[model samples]
Target: MTATVAAPDKTRRLVFPFTAIVGQAEMKLALLLNVIDPKIGGVMIMGDRGTGKSTTIRALADLLPEIDVVAGDPFNSDPQDPELMSDEIREQIAQDLPITITQKKVPMVDLPLGATEDRVCGTIDIEKALSEGVKAFEPGLLAKANRGILYVDEVNLLDDHLVDVLLDSAASGWNTVEREGISIRHPARFVLVGSGNPEEGELRPQLLDRFGMHAEIHTVKEPNLRVQIVEQRAAFDQEPQLFSQKYQQEQIELQEQLIQAQKVLPEVYLDYELRLKISQVCSELDVDGLRGDIVTNRAAKALAAFEYRAVVTVDDIRRVITLCLRHRLRKDPLESIDSGYKVQKVFDRVFGLES
Candidate 1:
């Protein structure tokens, strides 16, 4: 069964085009980096509601290239192609013959807040057993999201148990099951995407650390920008196809850029001086755990890749500091200034990315 939102006003629902979205440039940049490097963990967007969080994610889905996946595999594993699948999976599939595949837009499976445990994780196919006396396992959200994205809108509201499962699968790249007389483990690697209003609740620290990057955003403030958003959105509702068509060419261009960036990412070089700076910033902030340094380095590399540069620059590092380090830092909310700016001060004294 499909979930429905509280509101019935459906025709007016238009995802603001990536090009059309005003402001929030930082948020957009962080998301783009995650696409270039899935190992950056995953992106978690925190902000007030109606800040174009979900819309931005959906827009990315439209912008990204569809990937090839095994035709009947619930986990969306790649077929036995040495170049496409990882060496481990490639070897596993080599023993199996006649693998099949088709292109699919990396799935963005929305996990509803009130979903049952059985629904989130697979359950035995009781229908198959009752009717045919044969035990067949059924897959769940984790399985369906393999090689794609798993999105949680009100992520902070999710139960701890569900969050635990998400962490396990995300860290291991496989979802393990020992339920209902069936044991299964399959590849469940996915980009775990989440968005939430911080006012509602706090995301668990353990789960929060799982995300590769973090972006903070809010609705447009300037009246002109706000007006433009409303005007374009209304125009889109007046004629959906025409509005979408106008932006179609731009989306295609963005897609091409993304493809080029992906191809160039591995070539982006990181030197020792930059690594030392990243560690110094994190250490000064008193942010525990080494994930902060790892994420900062990864995010910087991704930004460099996006810029079509072969070397990661100080400019790239500074551009990504806020989103990558904000949540990880131990800070007092009373301080109006953000940890990113603090890192910035140190950066200017050291490498001078900004004037």
Candidate 2:
């Protein structure tokens, strides 16, 4: 919980540092874990206004190490991974053509509230394809978001159909757009982060369940913390470069930590008993699908990896289970128990952690 700041780059717009942001630990942790392992799916964050949701997310994107992409590629195609490469890049490889590699900051795409299906998913230019005898496709937000973070602010207000399309692409890791019998497919893998105020209305449980984790944040209740957050923001605004330099070392350390965690994630191990108990909690809670269990396991392993541990512990599961399963729980009109509390209660019983 050290206060860390991003190094000031005179050429780039300044963002409030990730570690420098005060409070909202759950939101921050969920985002970090997603970064460590995008296959855990994405995070759905519900919080009040002015909760620093957008700021924290942007800071995280800025905090990440730059990625190697094929030079001049529109999809931000990974130079080494064929699965992450665009069709053009892959075709070049097939033809044994030279490929240039370039480094770029991780892409962060914001899905605007009024975006159309074509805008979010991109469109196939059938006229150009038929006339030129080539599959001419115009990439959209999803294409730009590949191998990055796709953020949707006020996601609950988004059209349900659009949400479905986003979730599908996120889950499948590819987007296929078709028009006039011409189909275009490309990598669309990203850590989907959605934040909205609860008062705006909630995503349908079916759709909500698709997210890997759900984090709920509230306004800081302590007066001192609130004052501190306000002061930090003011200071950041007053002399952004000077303020950022203060915590630049911490930011670099955190960035290295994240990169190391990603490298270590594959070696992290989850115990069989812990896995059983995780599913037991999911089953006992009557969670609809295997996503809850799968996400909890992945999240726990990611947490262990982040802590530089090769083995997952009960504490790791304890830390992430609520975020992994709370939103997936079935809502009963008569039940007064909080979703997080209910998930924890079952976890304690199943994992034998009751005191």
Candidate 3:
């Protein structure tokens, strides 16, 4: 008998395609909505280690379309989006605009596990003035994320102050700088995608509400599935180009689905009963505030649109309720997952899902 040797794994050489990722249905849905309705805020994935949480998000940038942006701006705002312009700049655009544009990939700028406050938020250009006697406002990660996705892995571990900066900028859609006698404003609107292992610490409730959806991803332990994953991944490591070529068709098909979904999303209808059900479920669960209602509606509408449905339904809402409510649930003094599962069970009874 002859023994064959196996090739080494090389998952880091290239980003795995978003379409190629398996499982984590809610996570996938939330991200899809971020693309369809950037106003739904951002997707937050909280889960266990080795669950493919980060991989799914990193791969998403691959499926998005290239955007047209102003030629000189670091924040890649759409030349046409009004938020991109200052009042004066808006006037200039209004007055027979001289808007120069170029198409670029929608960015998925990563906030490293540990980054300084000054670097994450823009700071004044002291070096420019000290050396050349000229003042400048250097952009930061927040600025570059405009009209893109700002991704933070291990988000719960981020400094509280930095988290505040992110939330405020996200809510306002622009960064305000007031330091070193240089005050400036620029577009900072971007979907904030945060992924973390929940065992470390819980994200603040106020901050949690800001995320439009939350998905809990767990590792796949199935024997057959795991075997396939390892084999395909090892094959790709031995032949990168050939592997990507094989999935080229799959990527194209997924991209087409996304584009078609985007077109229909604007016209997708939210039914009256669905709206009532959303309110009822939120109240039943005793979840705080109105963001829950808003996110539930948005996620359901987006899910329907993704599935090529023309109208929202209970099924759509049920699929996304956990994603919208898991992080926003009021804290229990006892500390348990029951509060979350209880809400989900209530939703099932009211909305008619598998009990």
Best by TM-score: 2
Point out where model 2 deviates above 4 Å: 1-10
Cα lDDT tens digits, model 2, 312-346, are 99999999999999999888999998999999999
Q: How would you order the candidates by lDDT, starting with the best? A: 2, 3, 1
118: Cα error in model 2, Å:
1.1
Q: Candidate 2 clashing pairs?
A: none
Candidate 3 colliding pairs, count: 1
In angstroms, how far off is 212's CA in candidate 3?
Answer: 1.5
- Which lDDT tens digits does candidate 3 get at residues 147-202? 88899998999987888888788878888887766677787888898888879987
Question: TM-score per candidate, in order?
Answer: 0.86, 0.97, 0.87
lDDT of candidate 3 at residue 3, scale 0 to 100:
21
Clashes of each: 3, 0, 1
Off by over 4 Å in 3: 1-14, 85-92, 95-97, 126-135, 180-182, 333-340, 352-355
State the RMSD for candidate 2.
4.8
Candidate 3: residue 216 Cα off by (Å): 0.7
Please, what are the lDDT tens digits per residue for candidate 1 over residues 264-324?
9888899999999888888877778998899999999888888889899888888887788
Arrange candidates, best TM-score first. 2, 3, 1
